[model samples]
Target: MTSTNDSNKAAPRKSGPSRRGAMKTIAGAAAALVAAPYIRPASAAPTALRALMWEAYAVRDVIGAFEEKHKVKFAPTFFDGNSEAYNKLRVGGTKDFDLVQADGFWPSLYFREKLIRDMDYAKIPGTANYFPAFKPDAFPLLKDETSGVFFGVPFCWGSYGITYNVGEVPVEKAKSLELLFSPDYSGRLATNARFEENIALAGIMVAHRMGTIDKPRPDGKSFNPYKLTDEELDGVEKLLIEQKPLLLTRYQDAATLEQLLVSGAIVAAPEFAQVYRLMLEKKAKGELDITVDHTLKPKEGGLGWVDTWLISSGVTDAEKADICHAFIDTMIKPETMVQIGKASGCSTTIDIRLLSSAEDQVLYLMNRTDELRGMYMFDQPSSTEKWERVWSRVQAA
Candidate 1:
């Protein structure tokens, strides 16, 4: 099986304006207009907060709540993936936004590169309510234990698994990752275009089926089943290459993949739990016939992911401290978290009792700690390049 522990870093691309750059420009202009001390200072207008995040996450109700409570308008931009968001920010320049929703693993790279500013915790009183594990300090970025200093706040989290169409693959036979890359269903298979999670899933499946484990370096910290060895890598590579002729398309978005599945053009694909839930809904309505399954990959581990909210370093200290905190508080409320979970079709770290009956399944899957730990976080920087190479070969075939 392909090892999921490969590097998680994407090759930094020159994307666009960062939040910091935008703030600096605004600050410079404001400073230029200032006169003598005797002159009364102009009261700053309430700033319009702009955010770039997942489409479902930028809910109008959530933004409206913040706007009404804080008396500031919020404008949000949406992106399908973190890399797209990062690239937009890099190329667009910093002045375009006040906040960016990022995954936990990618924020470390952004923080190290100074793409975002350390948050002013004092203003955001809501930071206190977060679970310790979700704290930015818990990540590798902040080496110290300062309570309020953070680059991001926890947003939502979900796990990776094979989401197959039951109409195509029977339950008993489809209970493993093997079905995803099996030659029998190659031309009908679909996969996410996102490199990290896709590659990790592929790696784990390849490693396990080959009877090998790919161990972490040095201290040998590793997960169950075991790691993949050199021979296993070769075998996994061959398996993936052979299966290439069967793939229908390299999906870059879930909506498209879901639509394809609904149309019966694709049989089985590796995807987030959210997509599976949607498929389940369609199946229930009789508009589609499908089965949602989370097969256990015995040897190869699954992929794990976390989403977070980060304050733009460029925002005023006063705004960052107060508004950001308020936002966090608003999101963590049991009712609010439930709404978020239901709308996004993903489980969150917050307690699930707060959610409605509709969200029970998603909440259950997300909170499965034992199952979650078995999945791999996309923390490796080199994995993307490697996956791209593999993907190219797959496409070429």
Candidate 2:
């Protein structure tokens, strides 16, 4: 934490010496100087507040004001999916990164494992006005213990739903997951490759058909699609395998999926709203001549996500934690949240007054809480290990 001016205090002190002593001392000092640069660093390295989150969540324009206000560099590392982000945090990423803007519920695992630290809401007051857009139950996920020590702060809430080129798929037919399997689009369809999300989509179809989301498994056991039971996963896996041949590519990130969509290689897939924006950007910049626009929440409701901003537990520096909290404080502010909603099609905590052609107020579910019954939010299942094993079979198939 010391300044660069405090680089070294080992400079030789001035002293009187005999001529021979002075010459010997000078020679020795010269030798020491010759080896000094190799042995010691000239100055302390400048520190940056590191953020690991999704694409567009850390856009250059979105966080520009916060970066300037904090007078700190925002060093961002993005992940395509929540699984990869959690895996990285599990594998020493917690030690390297200071901030993580990941799935809204994922912080629960980090809180249980102590991978992330308790947040002082006093430090992140922006979260105080968290509702009117966020679900009432969403705040409970922030607390892992009864003592009320919170681990994470909420950021954006959105869906991993369908996006298809305008002309290729009609707006009416695009509102269902059935398109992913329809032979009409075989070899022209693409979808998210993430195990939980892809499998969850299958569960969504099941939930849609039977009118039994509370009991997702075909065997009649109660199961949440986000946390599918073993039997539930089995059903979902079978469905995905049956549809596999129809898929053109399995993608983990929005960028790759966007490339496929804009190139007209695949007509549709489950992707974030940002991809729709990317396609427009690409078209305007001449990166792609094609225009991609339609996005749908499956008739059965899509898998919804709420990404949270958490400071790593390994963050020992108080100053660094302050910087992370400062960034968090800006996240829910009306100005930044609007920019986020514009770049990302997700709903932000505060209402976004300014509207762009690409943005819609309904995406955040602002006053449309009635529709929430259909959306499935992300959750780490109790039977995660078993579900992951089943996912392996789905992929191997």
Best by TM-score: 1
lDDT for each residue of candidate 1 in 54-156, tens digit (9 for 90 to 100): 8877656876877988888787788877777778777753446667777736776666656667765555455554444554454433322343346766667
State, as a TM-score between 0 and 1, how close model 1 is to the true structure: 0.74
lDDT of 2 by residue, 355-388 (tens): 4233355434565533444566776655678778
Flag regions of model 2 displaced more than 4 Å: 1-47, 61-73, 128-131, 135-138, 207-212, 216-222, 277-296, 316-318, 354-373, 381-385
Query: Local distance difference test, per candidate?
Result: 0.64, 0.72
lDDT of 2: 0.72
Residue 115 local lDDT, model 2: 81
Error of 1 at 291 (Å): 3.0
Error of 2 at 332 (Å): 3.0
TM for every model, in the order presented, reads 0.74, 0.73
The weakest ten consecutive residues by lDDT in model 2 span: 37-46
